[model samples]
Target: MLKLMSLEIRKHKLTGLIKGVLIANLIILGFMVLVLFVDQNEQVSTFTSFGDVFEGLFVFVKAVFIIFASALLGRLVIEEYRSNTISLLFMYPIPRKKLLTAKLIIVFLFTFCTIIISDLVLGALLFWINHFLQIIPGQLTWILVKDELVKLGTGALYAAGIGLIPLYFGMRKKSISATIISSVVLVTLISGGFDQARLGNFAAISISLGLIGIAIAYVSIRKIETDDIT
Candidate 1:
């Protein structure tokens, strides 16, 4: 499992996805910082713990990540399915279960790790800017840091979690475009109703749903009859 994951991570670099996540956080944080900094509104916070800023940032990226995850996993599946690659792999006397497990673990952890890195960078950058002008008081303001981190972490996981659903769809469709669009539509419906409200317990539910989706995908892939194997 470790070797398989290491191989995929090395190939993809995961940096591109991390960059996407960071850019999204900053762009949205920019507007919020502007509003608070310019207007001097103490009540108006820069952190979008649950509102549109939180959810909105993922609006486009949500689907994009889904496609990425799907591609990350599906590419191998497709390779095995369409190109007769699985035979070489299967003939090695390696258990097919191990192969499937490795792929699923890599796909799941890759998404989680990307989110962790991106959120850490984003939270650091925004807090730096906020503290520079005393907007966020000082570096020792652990409360602000903690709050923001919690929100960002939660938001990120929620996204990465639900984001995997698209991979399943992508695997089914095997079409990049379809996976992308479908991912967007799914996120819209999931995160739509709780808009402008604190994610609260629903965030937990989202995480659960994400894990469930991943589990189902893993099992499905265990029996997946792809002819190619990357």
Candidate 2:
């Protein structure tokens, strides 16, 4: 699986996606900082506590990466099927299911690792900025750190699974636009709310949605051999 994933990465030149990820992180961080700075000058509390900051950061990170993962699915899976290049891949000595699973695994791990890393990095940068600028109130404590570590782990897992959800839509029609658009709608449904009352904040909702994505992947892999690549 690892060898196949590596081959897929090399064949697709996916290392280039790192630049896109970095740029996305920078944009998210900049927007966050700008919001805080503006709120500080207005004497308006944008985030009342460090927990709020963490939640806000995680929401942004998860939203971005979920969409990003859908794009990856489009490139690695749907595009191949759409272009009929997947027929060529089907001719390989590899088991069809194994090949498809490798692609899904790569997308999952990429989304998972990137979301966690980007959130941590951006959180640290925000803390450093707050230390000097005093943009947000309250002190960071060990308790907060411990709690957030748990949240971060669970949140990333949920997000990684949710990221795979778009594959179901894309595969239905072999349409990249459908994949990306479905992701956007999913993000809005999960992340949109007044004052941090997002659907994603609910553990039950996140878990259920994540499981749906995993199920989608499982079904896709199980049916790969019988699927008509033509």
Candidate 3:
């Protein structure tokens, strides 16, 4: 598994994937800053704890991470099939399932780590700015800190897991465009539901989507064995 994952990492080294991830993070940071400026009054009036600020940040993070996963899946999976490079990979001694598993694991880990880091960095930066600027009114108590940490960890996992749905779509269709487009549509619909339902919590919804992504991944791995490479 380590060897396969290493190989997968090397494959993506020159693919601009890392660059893209960095650019995405920067964009998110900029957007967060803009929101802080525009919603200063609202945040000051409504937010009572760190969790409140984290929740708002998470909404954007979740959406951006989903799109990031779709792009990675396109380059790593769909592009391979589209370019007929997967046939070349099949000629290797490695089992197709293991190869695919390595790729998926990389995707999950990459997405998971990126989200976690981004969340931490942005959360801290925002908190620091708030300390002096008083943009968001909240006390960073131990309880609030612990709760936000748990949320951040679980939220990253949820984003990574939900990403597999687009991976499954890309693998099934071998279409990069389909993978990206479907991901956008899925996130939009899910976000819309949350907006309308006013559930005020995304734990249940995220978990449900994560489960669906797992099921789709299982189907993808099973089908790959007999899937036509021609």
**For each candidate, what TM-score against the reference?**
0.65, 0.97, 0.90
Ranking of all predicted structures according to TM-score, beginning with the best and ending with the worst? 2, 3, 1
lDDT of 3 by residue, 59-100 (tens): 677778888888888888888988899999998998899988
Query: Candidate 1 on 1-230: residue-level lDDT in tens?
Result: 78866664564464455576656556656754675465456555443332333233343334445445666655554445445565766776667667666766666665666665645554455556755665543234467556656766665566666656665666664655555676667655664554355332366677786776767666566655443444
Scanning candidate 3 in windows of ten residues, the lowest lDDT window is 192-201
**Candidate 1 local lDDT, residue 61:** 38
Measured with C-alpha atoms, the lDDT of residue 130 in candidate 1 is 56
Better model by lDDT: candidate 2 vs candidate 3: 2
lDDT of 1: 0.57
lDDT for model 3, please. 0.78
* lDDT (C-alpha, whole model) for all candidates: 0.57, 0.93, 0.78
